[model samples]
Target: MTVFDDGERPRGGGPWPIWGIPLVLSLCGLVMIASLSLRNSMTGGSPYAQIVKQCVFFLSGLVLMFACAFSSLRRFRRWSGLLWFIALLLLVGTLIPGLGVRVGGARRWLDLRLMRFQPLEFLLLAVPLFLADRLDRSRREGFQGFLRPTLMVTLLSILPLLFQPNLGGTILVTLICLMMHVENRGWRYPLMGGAFMVVLFVSLVMIEPYRMRRFLAFWDPWSDPMNKGFQIIQGLVAFCNGRLFGVGIGKGLQEDEYLPAAQTDYIFPAIGEEFGLAGTLFLLSLYAVWTIRAYRIYRRCSNPFLSVLTLGLTMSIIGPMFINIGGVTKLMPLTGIPLPFVSAGGSAMLFMWAKVGILMRINKISLGEGRREREPEGC
Candidate 1:
């Protein structure tokens, strides 16, 4: 497929599934969290605390979404550098003496007095905006022209995440940057790039013993059932418990007692336990629809910056979705990234909305471009 597959905007399409699917998924998250919160309350773990916090996050996420949607894409392009720089600082801050919060032995969060924030999530949006702005044809284009900036951004971004020991984010961000820079020129480049990516992943796994163990555990979780495999095993049990139609919304056994990250990393399995195969399939379909629609926006986009930005933004969501689901389902080692709109992560929710907002802006601009193109036909 050529870089930006611009074509006649799909028929019967005005405001498409891009926005609607996330709203549905976000609502599902809220309902699921509320259910989990109720169970926590029953166990005397502070009633509705999870829901209350998530409610605040959900509202704040909407604000971030609208702010991005209404703002000028030009401004984002202009400010992409500053935003990325600030993100870099925050990411580095996560490693500072007292500034960083240690969770699961990884310093990936900042425990501000009010709440915790993951700078990594912000980087997901910032890196794309930066790359789209810097790599646009207006400044420079083509493989040789864009290679330096792409490598620089990838190295700078990936290093801190690696130190944070966030292999998943590192891989996702690195690949997204690589994916954005590929030109339509012939097979040699992509083939080489693909080989490079494989080497990079293998190297990354080899460098970290924990990562290697996880990789091996992915192939046979039974080998390390108590340690590396526990989360996936629990997640699988949730799927088993869910079976077909699930045990009912609030009645799930996994989220209440067994499942490891029922509201975040393993939320997919929790969804399985409560919603069943039918519900899980429906949710998967929503994600599929969301992915297809985002690409549709990318394809129709006329501007070069917006075009690359659309692909990058689409990756920000879909990449995490695949990584998280893969880990939970034992398709791959769990990287501990939250599911897109369905995870109960505050930083994740805010950034997820930000991505959707940017796409909405692009969709609006593309539609306008389409309308303007059609106006001359009437004359």
Candidate 2:
């Protein structure tokens, strides 16, 4: 189908190029993932361990993407609550000792027999679908409207996220909720909500002295270089090292030893060091294209529920990209957020692909298609 066509109906389940974007992006991720892990993986034990795991996650994600693409949104609506409920169960499970895996400082992952997974990642994707599904149904019948359910869903989703100390994920989830709320309920809710959030945040910050330190450090990391400020300073060093062309892939000095959290929160700095300014721009451009495509899909969606779902998923991806990149660049304070596809984490990659699945599904459903036309068949 042509770009301008108003046909919401998928013609004989025609092809679309949407899938290719994420697929190609995922391949780029594989390359970066391998390179980033080379130093640690080779020396620590197995030479190909991280690469193998990443490949596993990529394969799993590909399966999920297609499954979601062909699956009806209506079916998901019927089951969305259950999916979200399962996600919440996992989140709660993580807080239990022996259940949650602690790496660095946060206890955010659930240790399963097969794999360690971050429940918050699934929550990020599922909560949006759950809210959209419920709100859409409520609006259709014309009750008191989206306000009550929207507020409840937002609170329910975000409360657990915050408690996990996953601030970056919490912010992303909250912003997406706010966006859907505004789109459905109007501007008044967000304005009032924003005011309330500031008051709440200030209270929380006061209760936790570390939060205040983090805030101050975000502004200037050198103020406390040895403690709360270390990550940002290391990130700055990485970028400074790669003034123009970069040190070359897998040749990041920081990744070899200096930079802390090299494979996780500070992954972008490693990218900046190895890929340079030009490569960083190209990475940013990929996200920009993804953002534009996402918005276009949201605009074209006939179902209001799916439109908001698309928007939430898009924001989920864009939010982390910005926070991680900006934090390392010192443009924003350091937030322990992973660089979406490129980061070395199973759960993050899995849910990220799940969001892609949702995006692909929404576009498929919006156009009334059945089979997914892989390889960017051209929307």
- C-alpha TM-scores of all predictions: 0.91, 0.88
Regions of model 2 farther than 4 Å from truth:
1-17, 41-44, 139-147, 368-379
- Global lDDT of model 1: 0.81
What C-alpha RMSD separates each model from the true structure?
A: 3.7, 4.8
Number of the top candidate by lDDT? Answer: 1
Error of 1 at 153 (Å): 1.3
Cα lDDT tens digits for candidate 2, 1-379: 2222355533323224456666766676677667777677546666578789888988888788778776666667778899989988888787788998876566788889898888888888888888877766674322245446776777787777677666666667777787776666666667777677668766776787777788788787889998878877878888888778888888887646678877677777777788888777777887787777776777666556666677777888788888888778878656677888877778888888778877877776566463353322111
Q: In model 1, which range of ten residues has the least summed lDDT? A: 370-379
- Each prediction's total of clashing residue pairs, residues at least 3 apart in sequence or on different chains, is 0, 6
Clashing residue pairs, candidate 1? none
Window of ten residues with lowest summed lDDT in model 2? 370-379
lDDT string, candidate 1, 204-300, tens digits: 8998887888888888888888887777788888899989999998888754567777878878898898889998899899999888888777777
